[model samples]
Target: MTAILKTEHLSHRYASTWAIRDINIEIAQSGIVGLLGSNGAGKSTTMNIICGVLNQTEGNVFINGIDLRKNPEEAKKQIGFLPQNPPLYTDLTIDEYLTFCAHLRLIEKNKIRSAVEEAKERCSLGHFSTRLIKNLSGGYRQRVGIAQAIIHKPKLVVMDEPTNGLDPNQLIEARKLIRDIAIEHSVLLSSHILSEINLLCKEIIMIESGRMVFSDSMDAFNNYVQSKAILLRMDNPPAKTEIVKVPGVTQVDVLSEKQYRVYFDGSPEEVTDRLITASVEQGWKIKEIGPDKGLLDDVFKQLSSQSPQ
Candidate 1:
């Protein structure tokens, strides 16, 4: 199938410096793809260019096989966008704002009402249709923004930090709503939070310092970080020196009296087995042992280091 979204050598510049450089991305038909990066990592630049909010200095954006730069009007019909701060008119009622958005999306005059109603229902804004946007909570306002983005049922929805600033409860609700939307629309969600990307994305595209660093399935990204440490809990732990004596064992970090994070250099399975055997023979009384999935920051560091300079 043709990708829902594609960018070729996408790059943008500001004055004398490049904001994003040679960025390329492709998204499938109906799943959440995460745009992961730190602040100032060119994520927003790329997204804006794809959504046609900003023209790229060099590159092409294609939506559903239509070149965006060549035919913006037709290509944009397949895209929906929700930026970091939701664009909402506080004074307008939910119904009023959504109706206006439907007009903006150029839905048929006859179908506008049904389209508005459908968007309201999808975002759970039907109950607040008559409620003024300012009267609703932050979460509800966010829903209004989402309702506007999908009011026309675009094939690709690009959301920048959709869950940013939401409370725990609101965050959960937003995640669920995004997933539901993804069933029918391909969603490109961007966030700087590693945990958010881990939870919501099927595939990940990571950028760093204006450069494309990593792009692959989430599982591939997870496995990219080799198992370098194992968490071991013992009732009677041996000395650090004794632990390192095991083949492949490199170093040990004492987490607690009964727990240690053992660093190893070779196969994690082999190191774990040897540790278990050594524990039984040495009477260390192993309580709990498992390989540690290194921190996302470590993965970021490693990927950033390997990115093209």
Candidate 2:
């Protein structure tokens, strides 16, 4: 697949502290790419640099092979961004605000009205098109921001925390809108909501404390997590001490009075037999044995917390 955006060893700083460093990322064309991390994890920083909102102190950014530092105008023309806070003029009606956006993009005057109307319709803002932005709900405000982002029909869209404060219904609508736009435009979206990222993105890039940890498809991430689990469900519960002491097992948790989850730090090859022997030796009956979901969550937590070395 073609790359819509590429960064080579991108680095950025705030005074003496670096927000992200030596990061390389490739965003595939016309797909949803997620930048997933906790707040202060450098996701927003990366997005800002890519959009030319912030100049990287080092490294290169290529939007469709146009180096941002070399041709900012042409590079920026290919991107539309929805910031965490939608920059709407609350006093202006949706139509009026969208018109202003069209003008900023240098759209031809004759087609501006029709274009704004089309954008409003696409975001389902037809009914509220004449209402002041302040009168719109938080969700509607976001739609207005999205409408403005795409008013120029850019090839790539970058959104920062797009669904931060939405109700369930609004979240659904926002997701649908993202899906609709993604069919024609590549998107780099940021969110702490892992589920939303998992559902919408074909690829996920994670950053922490100003560094890229890893980036891969969902299947690869799942496989990495699964390989870390040593599924252990016993026919009967064993003593907590024994369960914890079993070779290779790192931790234990009671699933129920009759069930327990065992975690292993080493290979799972001998864990099943070891668990069975430990149970039988102690006069405990073995029940069903399988890895637990918490195991994967633990693995993810461990990996995500460690700065990339």
Candidate 3:
């Protein structure tokens, strides 16, 4: 499928320092793609450029095959953007606010009402249409922000930190809303929350110090760090030397008196069976054992540490 959004050699500069350099990304016609980075990692700068809020010093942005630089107005019409802090009029009622947004997006005057209603329903705001924007909870206000964004039915929705500042329940609701938005329009969202990204995004693009470090499907990202490592807990843990003596054991990390992280070569199942047999024969009471899928935090740390300043 053709990409709904694409950026090539995308770079931005602020006087002397480059905020983002030679960044490239592509999004398919549907699915949620995550943009991840630490603070000052240029995620905001990159999103701003893609949304046409900021012009790049170099490189190009294309939306639905329309060159953004040459045809900004046309390109922008195909995008729906929700910034970290949503742009909203506090005094306006939900109904009034969404109607205004519909008109602002140039929807036909005769069709604006239906468009606003549809957006409201999609964002689960059917009951709060008459409520004042400032009177709703944070989650409802976010729904209003999303309602305005999709009122015009743009091809791609770009949300920056959509789940920020929400309680646990609110976060769950927000995540569902985002997934609903992705059903019809492709999504590109920036987030620092790795677990949120892991749950929502089918693909991830990670940058550090303004440079691309990782970009791939979530499955591939997970598989990238797959290793023959196991977490073990025993009532009578053996010395590291005894554990290393087991065939296929390459390394061992003693996490605590009762726990260790063992690394090995060869099939995990076979190695695990061997270890179990040895533990039983040596009278080491096994408490627990499981494969250790390396953590996402570890991967992020490794990548970020390697990125140039």
lDDT (CA) for every model shown?
Answer: 0.91, 0.85, 0.91
Better of 2 and 3 by lDDT: 3
TM-scores for candidates 1 onward, in order: 0.84, 0.79, 0.83
Candidate 2 regions with alpha-carbon error over 4 angstroms: 227-296
- Between candidates 1 and 3, which one is better according to lDDT? 1
Candidate that would win on lDDT: 1
By TM-score, how accurate is candidate 2? 0.79
Instruction: Report the poorest 10 consecutive residues by lDDT, candidate 2.
Output: 291-300
Error of 2 at 76 (Å): 0.9
lDDT of 1 by residue, 1-309 (tens): 898999999999999999999998988679999999888999999989999999999989999999999999999999999999988999999999999999999999999999999999999988888999999988888899999999999999999999999999999999999999999999999999888998899899999889988999887887788868899999999998999999999899998888999989979899999999999999999989986644666787788777476
* Residues 191-276, model 3: lDDT tens digits: 98788898899899998999999999877776666556888899998898999998999999998889999999998888899899
Please give the lDDT score at residue 186 for candidate 2: 90
Q: How many clashing pairs does model 2 include?
A: 10
* Tens-digit per-residue lDDT, 178-197, candidate 2: 99999999999998767778
Tell me the spans in candidate 3 whose CA falls farther than 4 Å from its real position.
227-294
User: Residue 90 deviation, candidate 1, in Å?
Assistant: 0.8
- How far off is residue 72 in model 3, in Å? 1.1
